[model samples]
Target: MPERSSGRRPAALVIGGGMTGMLAAAVLSDHADVTVVESDVLPRLPAPRKGLPQARHAHLLWSGGVRALENLLPGITDRLVTRGARRVPIMSGMVSKAPSGQWFRRFDDARHLNLVCSRDLLDSTIRTEVLRLPRVTLRERTELIALEGDADRVTGVRVRGSVGDGVLSAALVIDATGRASRAPVWLTDLGLPPVEERVVDAGVGYASRFYRAPASTGEDFPIVNVQADPRRPPGRGGIILPVEEGRWLVTLSGTRGGRPSRDNGEFVPFARSLAHPVIGDLLAGAEPISDVVTTHSTANKRRYFEKSPRWPAGFAVLGDAVAGYNPVYGHGLTAAAQSVLALKRVLAGHALDSPETARHIQRRAARPVGQAWDLAVGQDVLYPGATDETPGRLERVAAGFIDRAVDAGARNPHALRVLLDVMSMERPPARLLAPDMLFRVFLGRKEPLLDGPPLTEAERKAAGL
Candidate 1:
């Protein structure tokens, strides 16, 4: 980490104190004085706030994101687990219905594992860690009105406070305001044109609710997922996640006209209609704790800020603000963590005051955005009424390869490990195209696909199934 000269602390101003913003603040705090300006008063515990409606749904911190979080805040995972977040081994702790069919046996190689918890708990834990940094300060109830610089350089930001307009100058300004960000307008105000944009809207809607688990099964229950078959007529999926507080956060999602309903009465029926009814059956005996909460903004949207000819100095955008992917893919937080890591790497080697540093960071951060964009858009484009343009030949080939690899993963442990690595964000998708992986895919599923969830007799009795 670099230090400021003249005994003055270098400052970085962050807009939106959500997970991405807080993670960025933590990374920046090592070398700079940081202040996070948030519009809503953040909660001290694992409670939802007005700003994050998506928190009502189930959120899985993929292994890659978990590693990044641990790197940013050591001992944080232990804290979360201590508080009841479940560490689910990739195939061992998951009962999944894949596009190919039901996944077969779990391999002993379990390096890839996802962290299952509510978005509220995940964000609150990270926020608490970030706020504990002495160099970091948080300004709740403060909103950013506009940028305070020209197209060539960004020196600071103008914020709206109870008193009036206030200016906070800093070497860097990070925008993490999420899917509804106004970074385009802010840049245009600085005499720059709108950044090139891309959208693959599947029009997916989500309906989620929390339920207290059956006492016999308790908090250690495995994650149950019934994924939508995109090749099917209507795209629908359901997930039962064992989150913090010994509860299951179940979400049912559908695309376009097949969207789930907010009617609490229809929730169970919708889950029951999924390709697999395990999630529905499990929910039958549990106690509902929250009403059905629904959201419809599950499109994959990206801004090509890094491609701009003249990116300003001392400014960068991250998280959903840069590229908001479909929540059904569960790539948002992992992408944000990867972006923060890129920022840390860029800042460590370059002078923050340098005019080219922000551009460099933005360019590096775009790598993850591009990868996630490709992954989300590839699947989303298959849905009805998803987009106007068809996938290009190369994209079609890529999707074909992925589909085959997923089919191979249904039985081959080696192929399954490779696929799970990519899905967990620990490895790039290119890993699946490696010679060894390609051989497995060529050979196809090594064993017969399981007829149902691989539950032991004891587990079945415990769930009263």
Candidate 2:
């Protein structure tokens, strides 16, 4: 650990100003003065930033993440809801067709809820909440040049701001940069071994657009999703999220050959071509609010920073820098929130200046990251050209059982409860393999599966179906 001036409070540098970075700053503010460095000038309102290209797509914050956010910034959820974000109950608030091709019953479960809103709103709210802390500051339009330390310990970060280049010395440096982080190169530049990494890309692509919600749908309109079936090559899916201001943030996605196109004329057709046409049918009567935005950066990439034998003492990485998953699973946001909570927990037990603190934080962050990784790749690996390495026997076995679980969940409320728990990231995937859960999957009584989406009469009428 590097020493500051005698009796001077230690300073922390957070590189990135997105959700994960904001949460990290909030937590670190308790122990040190924190400076958040961001390349883009952040918006005061719930508007998009250039750094977050995925903001145009729908984003879900699972109950696990909701709890984490509340823990980090108390009353933030209320603030979000007041600003038009929704707290939607999991199964009850969603009308979804599983990847295995079964429509889930809208079983009510208060325990599993998701925060639904535009990514811009969520980020803006969190950024506002974090910045209000007395000890935290934000440096916008600043570029991170390099880390200023040796392989053993990180002293601070070198940055080039509008004012010109300068070094910001700190006792701790946390990296919260997303999928495009340069941390791996930064680490290697400081004389460490290359971090082990794995990328499972189904060659997924996304095309998203906004639409005005139908007049007949009320404030509690449910999320409608049609998930892709990995067993089918070039799997296609779509979701209609009723976000704030009575608008729908609709996103359509597909693997490799089946990806959606950017042509405005093709957007609705693409949704109609999904495993189900419910999204398209609903959008047929709505008015477009935004042009179609497409992105192809939907790969599940993970860097094994925790496994590196020689981690620097004063530096740690969080969020998508640790792992970025396919957007369809909706676990990236949850995993990042949980990882920040892990950082909070580890910091409670370790001294900030200790050499082992960064290593400990890095390892703790990996637990949540790994959990989300397994869930995403469990299906992604089944795609034909996702990765060169074939699914191991264990992965295959897990997938078979998961398929059985999903089948049971679609028809049985009890099974669905357990499934939602795991899917929402409230519990580890191991919960699905419990003896009782296995019994429920194999022999539990179930309602007959529906032949089509179980849309309520009012919902069907609302879409003029």
Candidate 3:
């Protein structure tokens, strides 16, 4: 272990070393000397760590998130691109099928863009940039066991490390641990009321594999997606995303009974069975690069930490700790990035040691969390047996509106722009409900609906399909 400096500045403790945790540490560094602790030793290279199994699956960072990352760690996107990540322009570089069963046109003009890469690469890149700050120190192979303060204010963290058990006192404590976060229990242990919580479990599952890009496709291929229709039973979907190293990461997913299997032989066949066969067609000639990996932890869960009437002053929760979105929406990274931006906003005006500061920060952090939660469950709840919670009139209305927007987006670039703005998180969810967007939806698709995947001759020739 490297010797860390103990400065005279105020100190903060951030639990977790994943992207969100690192982002929290980066932001907290502006106000205090930050100490980041994790149970697993973070990898030095762009490789998977035990704590993040989802790294093996396809991950996309939307423009909304990319912008937030730029604000958090300047030049991060450039660093990632330089390290082999692809900056894919929104609809222009994508071939997609909406839940309405219409294939989207590959519009050349796009209003937003996203970064696609292995989750490992994305985390490692940000990790490198964040750890370089003199005010932030990394303590790998350490676990946060509990909070160190009372119900009124959190003063630090108690942890178990390489040598023995210990305590790290700080002016503020942050929990960035993902879906497995124990903050709720930790709060309960502090004599605070349990945070209100809900889980809209779609019973979503993922099965992902990697392949060498087909020789004919060369180096560039549009991202191919087949979205599941919640309106139909057995919601199933798949996406073929181009990552670094001439690789395409194909992830197949389904709700409940429709789930994909981890058996390697079953992978492509499942892809073949989606709403459309584009993912299957693209994978037909591709060379396999890795075995199938599956995860069943893709539920939309939220801990209403902000709603707690008694939030401790020295504490706040961020990232997957507050809300975990289904990965198919690809909003996890984006939401996490924005949550940190939210944290940065709160920290800018508040003192680190103030309990009021922590409470204010928690509420602001929950804003993005709530946005992402609504976005995910809106569709997820429509899946058969996804949740016991009944969808009310508002849910039906929102779903219907989104359905029309999807219909419009398939052909109308204007409608697509509005949808993309919301999808990118560059704009609020209401962007989809704006008068202009509603007019576009009412106007309907500009071009005739596509009968099949709109693959260009060059793309077909390259794909050898």
Q: Which candidate's lDDT is highest? A: 2
Q: Give the candidates in order of TM-score, highest first.
A: 2, 3, 1
| TM-score of every model versus the real structure | 0.97, 0.98, 0.97
lDDT, each prediction: 0.85, 0.92, 0.88
What's model 1's overall lDDT?
A: 0.85
Q: Is candidate 1 or candidate 2 better by lDDT?
A: 2
* Each candidate: RMSD: 1.7, 1.9, 3.5
What is the per-residue lDDT of model 2 for residues 343-417, given as tens digits with 9 covering 90 to 100? 898888876767898999999999989999999999999999999998889988889999899999998888998
Over 189-240, each residue of candidate 1 has an lDDT whose tens digit, in order, gives: 9998789998888888999998988888865577888888666747899888
Candidates sorted by lDDT, best first: 2, 3, 1
Give model 1's TM-score versus the native structure: 0.97
Candidate 1: list runs displaced more than 4 Å.
1-7
For model 2, what is the alpha-carbon lDDT of residue 281? 88
- Poorest 10 consecutive residues of model 1 by lDDT? 1-10
Clashing pairs in 2: none
The weakest ten consecutive residues by lDDT in model 3 span 1-10
Candidate 2 lDDT trough over 10 residues, lowest sum: 1-10
lDDT score, candidate 2, position 270: 90
